[model samples]
Target: MLWAHGSRVSRLPKDRCSGITPPDKMPTRAPWQALSVVLILLWGHPRATLACPHPCACYVPSEVHCTFRSLASVPAGISKHVERINLGFNSIQALSETSFAGLTKLELLMIHGNDIPSIPDGALRDLTSLQVFKFSYNKLRVITGQTLQGLWNLMRLHVDHNKIEFIHPQAFSGLTSLRLVHLEGNMLQQLHPATFSTFSFLDYFRLSTVRHLYLAENRMRTLPAGMLQNMPLLENLYLHGNPWSCDCEMRWFLEWDAKSKGKNSQCDSWMPSPYRSGNIPFSSMPVLLCLGSA
Candidate 1:
């Protein structure tokens, strides 16, 4: 019997539960089990939780989609482990050098449908592992030589539907792995011979590796001689929707067009009288009189 604060309490008999162990004689947890608990608390669970960026959904471990968010600029705190980033349909006007500084694992970057006017030199130098880049439907006016310095592994580039007026001679110097280039719907009037060729002092040239090239709907009247001769692996060429001057400067293109075995080499121009609604092939149409003798 035990005496309480204001009443007396009765105790149970010692033979009530003879199988039960006393409090001091109970066995303790093994040392290995206690060590595992401590390790789990320090390292967390196996499926570790990810800290996603605000206002952007991270559904997978490698991709981050931030499209149509009305974002004026690129958001901060993006994970470096991400491989792909989609920032399309935004109002981003500019990109700094540190925009993608430490994201070495990034492969695909899509920043199209924005209002970018120009890119500073070395702004994209950190994207060493980049493969595909899309910059269409923007307000770019020129492509400087240093604008695309460090994209060594880039394959496909889309810069169409912009306001590009000029491209420097060495604008595509280090892009040896480039396969496709889309430059349609721009305001380009001319192209340098060295734009796609690397000249050596021994009077030889190394051609580019581009396969598909699009230069449609531009303001080019004539292309420099030997422009297409450098692209040996070119499969598709789009040069329609331009007022071509059928003169001696264009006679080489006509001869090359007849002998080339490319799949799609469209160089048609829109006619008015009989072919108003359709485009006539440059080789079949004799109505385009030569402005000068070839």
Candidate 2:
């Protein structure tokens, strides 16, 4: 009889044991076979044995946490099944085209808390399934055309807290599904009319899907006439902390903005009169409390 303790016992009586096999004569499992069985039970499942990268944490198969690692570039050996990648709190300076090349299933990519100065063309070319792209708290100075081209499914873009000075006329032309844009805390001097011209599309009539625009804390002097005419779905516009020149050139904008969206636009201060009026000093522009509309 096979005992539960891995030992064999004789079940036959002594009189019948003449033809019965002895307990010690039974076949025994080899030591290596028992060890192999133990190894198979420990590592037989792929998920239980998948190795995570060094200095990084992969608590699950779909999420990776590589924060505060001081990584200079994108790390390798990340499983392609990963859906969310958090690379925040690093010293990554530049992003090349192949940085995220094979990460097809990546959905949420967080590269904030870095020192990226400029984003090259096709830098984010492979993130087709990416929905949220954050590049905040960087040293980006300019946003040229094609700098943000291949993001079709992008919804929320946070480019705030940078030194962006000049945005190319067609910099934001390809964000068709974009809903929120945060451009506050930058050095934007002017917002060209063509900057948002490509955002309009034909649904039944011309329409825009952009809902919120945050341009606060910049150096905007005056906005072009009819700049927000195409944004049919615009709900909130934050334009405070800018030196707005309130004059005859702003008459149409003021009237249109006031009538279009009641109290949606705002500004810090406005000049009561036109600039260079009788060689008037720029400091003479009155600082009055007026919403930045029109």
Candidate 3:
């Protein structure tokens, strides 16, 4: 007689073995085998887990923790009821259209702390409900018009600390809801003139704002004198800690900035401003754009 413990015993007397016919005669399951089969069906499979809960899974119901997981690639779909998905601290290199296949209801997706060099085309095409998109601390060096397509509802974007060198002029055309952008630390050496030509609702005023406008740590040695003609609403300009070559090229900034101002034409000209005091003009304190004394 075969028992469920992986062992078998000899048949007993006829009284005990009454039901024991040939091995293939009856349905062939012993009493223990019947119980074993029932137990197998009762218990589910083993517990296997992905790095985090799918956005459609348990995350939408509440705040989910997907931090510090070493996931190299993304799995398939998420749960239909999930909402906030945090997938930070991974080695994710690229973003494909197939990565996030079914997260339609996802709102906040924290994809910071990864190795993403650049976002691919249509990476986030159908996620209609995405709100806050975070992609900080990566190796991203470029931004294209197609880098951000389907995130029509995105509000706050944090791509501050990265290796971004420049943004395609049309990159911000489709992002209508962008209020404040943080691009403090980057490799942005310069900006393109056609930058805001396609700005959907973005203010057309500050032309420098398109350069991530960080002049404090400017890598550019000189400012194109006449480039400021197109921008008018510039309130604050930081040109500190930069190597500036005082010459006629920057003279355009003086001439064009004066012409761009449609209001109060007498306050001060970009040429006679205080930014030029210590750098070039030592006689006065009018914010003049000049060569740094030090």
Ranking of all predicted structures according to lDDT, beginning with the best and ending with the worst: 1, 2, 3
Candidate 2 lDDT by residue in tens digits, 1-294: 333434756454566556667768866768778999988987766456555777789888788899999999878777666778898889998887777877777788888889999888877777777888888888899988887777777788888999999998677676778788889999999977657544644522334567888888899878887667767777887777777665445556666665764553443444454323332222232322233332
Estimate every model's Cα lDDT from 0 to 1.
0.78, 0.73, 0.58
Candidate numbers, best TM-score first, in rank order:
1, 2, 3
Supply candidate 2's per-residue lDDT for 232: 71
Tens digits of per-residue lDDT for model 3, 141-205: 88887777787776666776788877887775665554445554666666665443323345554
214-275 per-residue lDDT for model 1 (tens digits): 99999987899887887787888888877665444676887888888744444544334444
Q: Give the TM-score of candidate 3.
A: 0.56
Worst 10 residues of 2 by lDDT: 280-289
Which residue runs does candidate 3 get wrong by more than 4 Å? 1-63, 194-294
Q: Worst ten-residue run, lDDT, model 1?
A: 285-294
Best by lDDT: 1
Candidate 2 to truth, TM: 0.72
Candidate 2 overall lDDT versus native: 0.73
On TM-score, the stronger of 1 and 3 is: 1
Prediction RMSDs, each to the true structure: 8.1, 7.4, 12.1
Model with the higher lDDT, candidate 1 or 2: 1
